[model samples]
Target: MILITGAAGYIGSITSYHFLKNNYKVIGIDNISTGNARALEVLNKFDNFKFYEGNFGNLELLEQIVTNNKIDFVVHFAANTSVFESTQNPLKYHDNNVSNMINLLKICEKYDINNFIFSSSAATYGEPKTNELITEDTPKNPINPYGLTKLIGEYILNDLSNAKKEFNFIALRYFNVAGASLIAPLGQFSKSSLLIKIAAECAANKRDKMYLYGNDYNTPDGTCVRDYIHVDDLAIAHIEALKYLKNQKTSQAFNVGYSKGTSVKEVIDIMKKISGNDFKVEMADRRTGDPSSLVASNKKITSLTDWKYSNDNLELICKSAYEWELKI
Candidate 1:
C-alpha cells in the first residue's frame, strides 16, 4: 500500500484517485486545513482507499498509521504553497513545510519505507539569469520562503540518500500546475489565487473581475511566462516516478512540464476563447516573488521515465478548468 499525505488537496486527491483506479491500495492523510472535504468524500468511494484526518506532522499519528499499515511507498504533498503568504509569514512556512517534512522523513526512516515521491516546485529556481527553459542542473536561488522550504526539503532528501544506501527518492519539480480533472467532481474545490482558477471563476460569474499581478515583466508581452501542465498529466508523472524508483534504487529529480511557455496574456486569451467570456482583467504591481519566465525542459522526465504528456493543449486545459468551475 502507498501512503499519501495531503490526499484531499487538489493534486493529491487527483493522484490518489489515479492510484486507486490502477488497483493500488492507498492510505491518505489530510488535516483539512487547505484540502477540500468534497475531494476527500470522492476518494472515500473507493474500497481500496483509506483515510486519516490529521496533521501529517503529528508523530504519534504517523507512528500509529505506519505501524498499522504496511506502507511500501510514500507520496508527500502536505505543505504551505503560497508564495505571497510565505513572504508575510515566513516562520509558518518554515514550521509547516520544512520542520514537518523533517518529521515525516524520520517516520519513513524508522519504518524502513525507503521509496519516496516528493512534490517539489519550479519556484525553487527563482528568476534565472536568462529566460531559457530550466533544467535540473540550474542554480537553485529561491526568492521566497515557499520556494526556500521546498529547496531545503530537496536538500534533506539528497543528504539522506547520500548517507543511507538503502533509501531512494524521486523529486518531481512541477511547473505551473493548473486545470482540473477531466473526470467530473474531482477538480480543485478549495479557493485559490491561481491564474487559471481565477479565470475560470470569472467565466462562471463567481468573480466580477480578476487581477493580473504584473504586466510589465521582461517577457514578450510584458507578462510572466509559465509552463502550464494539466493536473492529470502531472499525476501520471508521480506514478511513473514510483515505477522508476521500484525498478532502480537510485535517487533523481525530474522536471514535470511540457517544455513550452505561455504568457499570462495568452492564457487569458485562451480562457476567454474557451469560456466565451471576456472577463475584466485589471493590471497590478508584481507580487513579491513573481518570476518573469519559468518554462521547463521536460526532456529529463520524458527520456528517463515512462511518463508522457497527453493534455498539452492550452485550450483543453482552460476548457477543463472552466467546466469544473461551473460545477463548484
Candidate 2:
C-alpha cells in the first residue's frame, strides 16, 4: 500500500486519483491547515482510497495508519510553501517543513517503509545566478527560510540513505506547479499566493485588480520568469519516480519541469486572453528575494524514467485553471 501525506492538497489529491486509477491502494492523510477538504471528496469516490484528516507530526497516528495499512511506499507532500510567509515566520517553516519530515522519516524507519518520494521545490535553488536552465546539479543557494527547510529535508534524506542502505528515496524538485485536473475538475482551492491563481481570481472577478510584484527585472518582458508545469504532469512524475525507486537501489533527486520559461506578464496575458476579461493590473515595487529567471532542465528524469510531459503547453494550462475557477 502507498501512504500519501498532504493527500487532500492541490498536488496530492490529483496524485491520489492517479494512483487509484492505476489500481494502487492508497492511504491519505492531511491536517487540513491549508488543504481543501473538497479535494478529498473526489478521492473518496475510489474504494482503494482511505483518508485521515490529521497532521503527519502525530507519530502515534502515523504508526497506527502505517501498521494497519502495511504501507511500503511513502509520497510526502505536506509542507508550508509560502516563500513570503516563510520570511516573516521562519520558525513555522522549520517546524512544519523540516521538523515534520524528521518525524515522518522516523516513522518510516520504524515501519520499514523502504521506498519514499519527497515533494521538494524549485525554491531550493533560490535566485538564479545565470539565465541558464537549472539542472539537478545547480548550486542550491536558497535565499528564503522555506527553501532552506526543503534543502535541509534533502540533506536528511541523503544522510539516512547513506547510513541505512535499505532505505531508498527520490526527491523531485518541482518548478512552478499550476492548473487544475482536467479529468476531475479539481483545481487549486487554497488561498494561493501563486501568480496564475491570483490572475485567475482577478479574471473571475473575485478580485477587482491584480498586482504585479515587479516589472523591472532583466528579462524579455522585464518580469520574473518561471517554468510552469501542469499538476497532472507532476502527478505522472511521482508515479514514474515510484516505479524508478522500485527498480533501483539508489537514492536520487530529479528536476520536474517543462524545460521552458514563462514570464509573469506572459501568464497574465494568457489568463486575460483565455477568460476574455481584461482585469486591471497594477505594477508594484519588486518583492525582496525575487529572481529574474528560474527554469528547469528536465533531462535527468526523462533519461532515467518513462516520464514524458504530455501537457507542456501554456494555453491549455491557463484554460484548464480558468475554467475550474469559473466553476468554483
Candidate 3:
C-alpha cells in the first residue's frame, strides 16, 4: 500500500484522488489540523483509501502504520507552509516540518521502506540573486525561517541517502500550488483565506474586495511575480517521480513549476474579470518574506518524469479556483 501524509490537505487530498483514480491502493494519515475534513469525506468513499487521523510526529503511531500496512511508497505533503505565519511562530514550523520529517525518516529506516516523494516549496530559493528560473543546481539561499526549514529538510534527506539508507526519494520544489481537486465537485478546499480564496470571496460578495500586498516592486507590473501550477499537474509529477524512484534511482530535487510567472496585479485583474466585481483593491505595504519574483526551471521534472504541465497560465488556474469556490 502507498501512504500519503497530510492526505486531507489541499495538495495531499488532490494527490490522493489522483492516485485512487490511477488504481493505487492508497492509505492516508493526517491530524486534520489545517486539513479540510470536507475533502476527506470524498476520499473516504474509496475502498482502497484508508485513513489514520494523526500526526507523523507521533513516532509510535507512524511505526505502527509502517509495520502493519507494509507501506511501499510514501508521499509526504505534511509540512508547515505559511511564510507569514511561520515567521510569527517559527517554532511551530520547525517542529512540524523538521521534527516530523526526522521521525518519519527514522521509521523508514527501521522498516526498510525507502521510496519517498516530498512536497517542498519555492520559498527554498529565497530572493533569487537574479531573475533566472531556479534549477535543481541553483545555490539555495533561503531568506525566511520557513524557507530555511525546507532547506534543512532537503539536507536531512540527503544525509540519510549518504549514509546508505537505501531510500530512494525526490523533492519537488513547488512554486505556487493553486487549484482544486479536479476529480471532485470541489477542488482545493483550504481552511485559511489564501490569495485565490480571498479573491474568490471578494468576487462572490462574501468579502469586500481584496488586498494587493505590495506594488512598488522592481518588476514591470510593480508587483510580485509567482509561477502558479495546477495541483493535478503537481500530483501527476509526484506519481511520475514515484515510478522513477521505484527503478532504484538516486534521490534528487527538482523545481516543479512553469518557467513563467504572473504578477499580483494580473491575478487581481483576472479575478475581477471572472467575478465581474472590480475589487476596491487597496495597495498595501509589502508582506514579510515575500520576494518580488520566483519562477521555476521546470526542466528537471519534465525530463525526469515524462510529464508536462497541463495548465501553466494564470487565467485557467484562477478560473478553476473560482469555479471550485463557487461550489464549495
- Please give the CA lDDT of all the candidate structures: 0.93, 0.91, 0.84
Model 3: per-residue Cα lDDT over 76-135, one tens digit each = 998888898888899999999999899998888888888888888888888988988888
Candidate 3 has a TM-score of 0.97
- Candidate 2 lDDT, tens digit per residue, 145-209? 98899999999999999989999999999999999997775889988998988998898898999
TM-score for candidate 2, please give it: 0.98
Q: Which pairs of residues clash in candidate 2, taking residues 3 or more apart in a chain or in different chains? A: none
TM-score of each: 0.99, 0.98, 0.97
Task: Evaluate residue 205 in candidate 1 and report its C-alpha lDDT on the 0 to 100 scale.
Answer: 87
Ranking by lDDT: 1, 2, 3
Between candidates 2 and 3, the one scoring higher on lDDT is: 2
**RMSD of each predicted structure:** 0.8, 0.8, 1.3
Please estimate how well model 1 matches the true structure, expressed as its whole-model Cα lDDT: 0.93
| True-structure Cα RMSD, model 3 | 1.3
Q: By summed lDDT, which 10 consecutive residues of candidate 3 come out lowest? A: 185-194
**Candidate 1 at 9: error in angstroms?**
0.2
